[model samples]
Target chain A: MRQLIDLFVSFFKIGLFTFGGGYAMLPMLQREIVEKHKWATEDDVLDYYAIGQCTPGIIAVNTATFVGVKLAGALGGAVSTVAVVSPSLIIITIISTILRNFAEYAVVQHAFAGIRVAVAALVVVSVAKLFKKGVKDVLGYVIFAVSLLLVFFLDVSPIWVVLAAIAIGVGKALKAGKGGEQA
Target chain B: MIYLCLCWEFFKTGLFSIGGGLATLPFLSEMGSKFGWFTQEELANMLAVSESTPGPIGINMATYVGNTVGGVLGGVLATFALVLPSYLVILLVAKVMERFQNNRFVQSSMTTLRPASVGMVGAAILGVLQSVLVNMDAVRAMAWSQMLSWPNLVLFAILLALYAKFNKLHPVVILAIGAVVGIVCKL
Candidate 1:
């Protein structure tokens, strides 16, 4: 019971301080979970991050679940997951409620217009970084271009695109395996 | 019914939105249009708010949208549903934790999925540009000069330059600067 409460408080702090997105939570995770708590080693955190990226759901939440399960059990995972998002739920609910009421104000509208531009600028940077980080070779470039076309032009659902990528990846791996065996 | 739809949409987002929080943007854009729950402008607003606040952007977005749709219960439900898949998948992975990361299939899938995720986010930039930089109504009416929102474009350029120069400024500070500029310049 005490362990569960500790998991909740620790993750709640993580969620509270994590600004921007899941990636921003890494430093906090390192500081608290690794240095402070000694719950997992640095390599363990990295492994969890790798698993979190590939798995479904938000990366931060996935990481929280992984660490939570490691520390306690399934119940710990649940507790941590809920704790991590509690801050977001409470804070956003308040902001959304207030914003909805004031959305009609001229000042609010103007602020949002400017805010949107900033957000777009930030996203442009993020997408550029993502491309640089992810698109490593010819095959990666091809998948990226095709995926962009499919999503932007054809309006294909992203889930289908992800599934197709998985199939292609598995096929490529199997072909490599066959070649290795023969060689 | 709306609550059910919200659950399903967010659940699917959680299950398939690989990469991170930003990866969920494309799906949220689709959901906004499909359900008439929010407009493009509203989505932009949500993105700004999500960025400025604490926690993961995906969770922040889910709670915001859910709150907009069905009050507090909706917010709670949406957030819970979004985390549900992760909760279950993590539990399963925990039991078999040792071999899971070394498995060949997960590695290959992740390699391919990475680029694909970037592509989706790339597509999302276009949507953001359309809503923030260009006035579609003006374009539809063939008002050439009026089609572009110069103030927004100028603000975008300035922010981009600032980001390029600083390279380490916090996003919240940049967002605050944007709001101050917006009110002063009447953007």
Candidate 2:
């Protein structure tokens, strides 16, 4: 019982401080989950990060679940996931309700205009980073190009694109067998 | 019924939005138009607002949309639905922890998934840029000269330059600067 509360409070703090999305939360995660609590090691956190990246849902949520499961059990996972997102639920509910009322003001509109531009700029930066990190080899480039064309030009669902990639990945893996890295 | 609908929508989003929070953007945009929950312009506004606040962007969006559609209970339910898949999948992985990491099957899928996810993000941001930076109504009216939003573009450029120069600056600070500049320049 005490462990559960500790998990809740620790993850709540992590969630509260996580500004600018999931990656920005990494340092706080390292502090709380690794250094402070010692619930998981550095390698364990990194492994969770890797698994989180490939798995469905938000990486932060997945990572929190992984740690929670490690600490207690399925119940811990449930508690931690809820704890991590509680801040978002509460804070955004307040902000959105307020914004819905204030959004009609000309000043608010102008402010959002600037904010939108800034958001786009930041997304562009992320795209650059992702492209650099992910598109390394010929197969990777091909996968990226195909995914881009399908999602952009055809307006296909991203889920289908991801599924197709998985099939292609598995096929490549089967073909290679245990003969070292394919890429 | 609306709660169930919200649950299903966000459940699908959670199950498929691989990579991270921003990956949910494409699904949310589709949901917005399909359900008539929000407009593209409204989505862009929400994205800006979500990024500026604390916690995960995807969860923030789910809570916001659910609240708008159903209520506070709806918000909680939607977030739970969005998290359900991750919980189950992580649990399964944790059970098979020893073999999961070194497994070639997982490795290969992850390699391809990485680039594919990035491509999806690239596509998703294109839609956002259209809504935020381009004057689509002007383009639809065939006014070529008025297709771009110049003030927004100028602000975007300045922010991008600032980010490049001071890469360590916090996002909240950058957004605050944007709000201030908007008021001062009347953008």
Best by lDDT: 1
Best by DockQ: 1
lDDT of 2 by residue, A1-183 (tens): 999999999999988888756787788889998999899998889888878887899988998999999999999999999999999998988898898889789899888877777878888887888889888999999988888788877888888988898998898898898555555
lDDT of 1 by residue, B129-180 (tens): 8899898999999999899988888889999889867879887777888899
Interface RMSD, every prediction, one decimal place: 1.0, 1.5
For candidate 1, report its TM-score. Answer: 0.97
Residue B165 deviation, candidate 1, in Å?
A: 2.2
User: All candidates' TM-scores?
Assistant: 0.97, 0.94
Query: In candidate 1 chain B, where is summed lDDT lowest over 10 consecutive residues?
Result: B97-106
Residue-by-residue lDDT tens digits, candidate 2, B48-138: 7788788888888888878878888988898999999999999998999868877888888888988998888888788878887889889
What digit string (tens of lDDT, one per residue) describes model 1 on residues A1-183?
Answer: 988888899999999998876888899999989998899999999889888988898999999999999999888899999999999999999999999899899999888888888988888887888889898988899899998889888889998998999998898889888999999
Off by over 4 Å in 2: A178-183
Best by TM-score: 1
